[model samples]
Target: MLLFNTAAADVFYKQPKTCPHCQSEHYSLTNHSKILRFTILPVIPLSISYQRQCDDCGYMTPVSWYALPTLEMLSIIKYFAGVLLLGYFLIQTVLGVHQQTTNEVSYINKPKLFDTYFVHADKFTDTPKRINNLKVAQLVEFDNDNMTFRVGNYTYKYNKDIEIAMRTSMLVQDNYFSSKTMTFRKEQIQQFYEDNSIYKIMRPELYSLFGGFVMHPPKPKPLYTGVKLDKHNQEGITYFKDGLYTEALNSFTLSAEGGYSWGQLNLGQMYRDGQGTQKSLEKAAYWLNKATQQGNLKAKIELAELCLSYDCSNLNTD
Candidate 1:
């Protein structure tokens, strides 16, 4: 039993020179109305009763059957249409800005493969062992598939394995090749033997796996002392491999505080395995979930394994 009401007032008609009753020049005709509704629904027709008032005499008289002008109705329609058009444009502008921001974020996260170089051999071989050292040549191309390069006025097509290895080694050197970030599509680590520069810097022992080719040792670079999250995570991995769990935990914690996904994954693993502190499934799940939210595939796999092997009834599945 709810009651609702609305009221409005507007000029119904303009008086011609003077009021009829008072014989005054100042006069006007105005209409006032009220509408009743029940339960928020209109239950009465809209009606306007006009009144003629003489400004000089202070006299009022009732009038009837006043219709709204066609021009006034058109103006109201145009005003509403203008408001709708403005709202539509505003919505499009907001959506465009949101899409642009999304594109910018994706561009920053994806690795750019521009202006990169690779090494390939002309003689086709199943393994790096059969590749002739003299046939080794420098190549540069943009397309990931069908690598075409010219070396000494001779064009050659490089094997897919060789291309994959070169790209993987490049990303590794750039510190972006990892499970927590971007990883190589193929598991052809054996092809790394093709790159002499990478072998000399990373795996010198693998040199014997390929043809013996003399390569100049890389010059020593200045050690970095700045606080970098990736460096901290790498240091933590080194300590963990050496069984210094306390030092590894501290490094991982520092790296995780800086929002490194790899560091968060390692810290979560340490908590689950009870390496540097008491084993706590809750803490492990918390850190692992954080890493998973950042697109860490390794963290997702680890969290799934933890849930399957332990009590995770209270864990958030979402």
Candidate 2:
């Protein structure tokens, strides 16, 4: 419940008079006090009340409907209006400053992928020492369709396998860790692209151009089980490739539980293929849909295939 009241002591009306207590000729009779109240219970009065007083003698008397001088009333009105306007402007200024400070701190705290790293294509070699010795160059452009990029005046091309790896790395960097979380905002993505060296560091192939620089990819923090989710996902992929479906399923399950999209997609595929698990279209669709929500194109394609082949009319393929 909200309750409030306002009280004002102002000279509503004044007149020259002789003080009864002080017996002074310089006495002034004035109507002063006023109060207004609002309460949840309707017991409080809403009207303003006033009282008259002798300014010199401090003698109080009852007042009934005293008339205020026009000039004095205008002066009181101007004073209150000025105070309210100043308070409003002060509040607005404080809020604006607070919002600006918050934005500045947020920008300062955002994760940065690299610090002063540069690209080098001409120094392509097989030795780590040579790669370290190579001078850094500035990157120009990247061609997603051709899987090629330009650093300085040199252009480098990568194979389809490398392209897939690069894209996977980008996706993992974007989704696997909170520090490197990606936003869908075009302005933010553009800012990241322009301000960071992530594009050059994303692919080992790009690092190969710098004489196999061999910068290790960033990994997620280990969980309570002392295993990183990405490691489990990678292990699952390796097991799957080696035809170890049962082991792959275990690893993928752990990874999927940890919210790894790669593992989710793989687990969905295993469920669909009946590899180390009973084939269940419902389970496949569920896991695939989970992965697809995280921008997993492969999972989306698999989901589309499942929808097409099984005539899953209830599924939202789009």
Candidate 3:
């Protein structure tokens, strides 16, 4: 339950004043103050009235407006300092977010090195686990068609309560374990922005305050077209060619979970053939269908063959 009440108090301060009743210069200034309160806490000021009292005779009279010094008025203004500070803080926060958003858009279009993007990890892959969903991708290189990012190995759970300090940690050097990088098409990056998958972008220049270059000089790492997902898919193919079906299946599973259509197709075949696991037509159809949706023609053929025995009517073959 909420309890509200107004309480008044007379704040007395020593001030030079001539009391009308006593004709004495020794007087105290007092304000008849009332405040709106919630429970035991004062919420706001309601009203205030000023008067002067002679200390020697205990006589009270109205305050004289002409006698109040400029410094005294400034003292009264200090009472509203809390309210003023609160207003300024709120305005600054709104402007800061707006300016940062503008900077992100500008940075994204220009494609600078070391520009960091805070993104949803699940969106980066097709079958992502929820245990760790918040991730960051730092820009490494870009071309007309595609842009590459060094993805962080470490991930955190996303929530509204997560603070900026936690998010900023994603950009720290050690997070990009094993120098893993992922490349995305320019069109896909645009789609990510449209879907709000990328929430914040921080530029390399922001790290100068911490002496980023002087602390750790940038070393040129060789760029490779084979990202993690593609590498997994290729590894599966090599294992399959070498008659190592179990290893092929394991690699394919990793690749498929990371959103590789070819990996999905190969993994479906392994399930159907019972190479590494039991032959389950249902599982085959499920994975094959996923690949087919991503425009993999080989998966369509395999899925159609699997449907010859299983119920194609229940699957999304079209």
lDDT of 3 by residue, 110-140 (tens): 7877776778878864437587787766778
lDDT of 2 at 263: 91
Per-residue lDDT, model 2, residue 172, is 29
Ranking by lDDT: 3, 1, 2
Q: Give lDDT tens digits, candidate 2, residues 84-134.
A: 666789999999877754643343234222211233233322124332232
**Model 3, position 22: C-alpha lDDT score:** 78
What is the alpha-carbon RMSD of candidate 3 to the true structure? 22.5
Candidate 1 per-residue lDDT, tens place, 65-173, comes to 4344454333333223434666789999999877754643332233232212222322222224323322222222323333322222222244444334443442223
Q: 1 or 2, which is superior by lDDT?
A: 1
Q: Spell out the clash pairs found in candidate 1.
A: none
Tell how far residue 84 is off in model 2, in angstroms.
70
TM-score of each prediction:
0.28, 0.28, 0.49
Best by lDDT: 3
Off by over 4 Å in 2: 1-229, 311-318
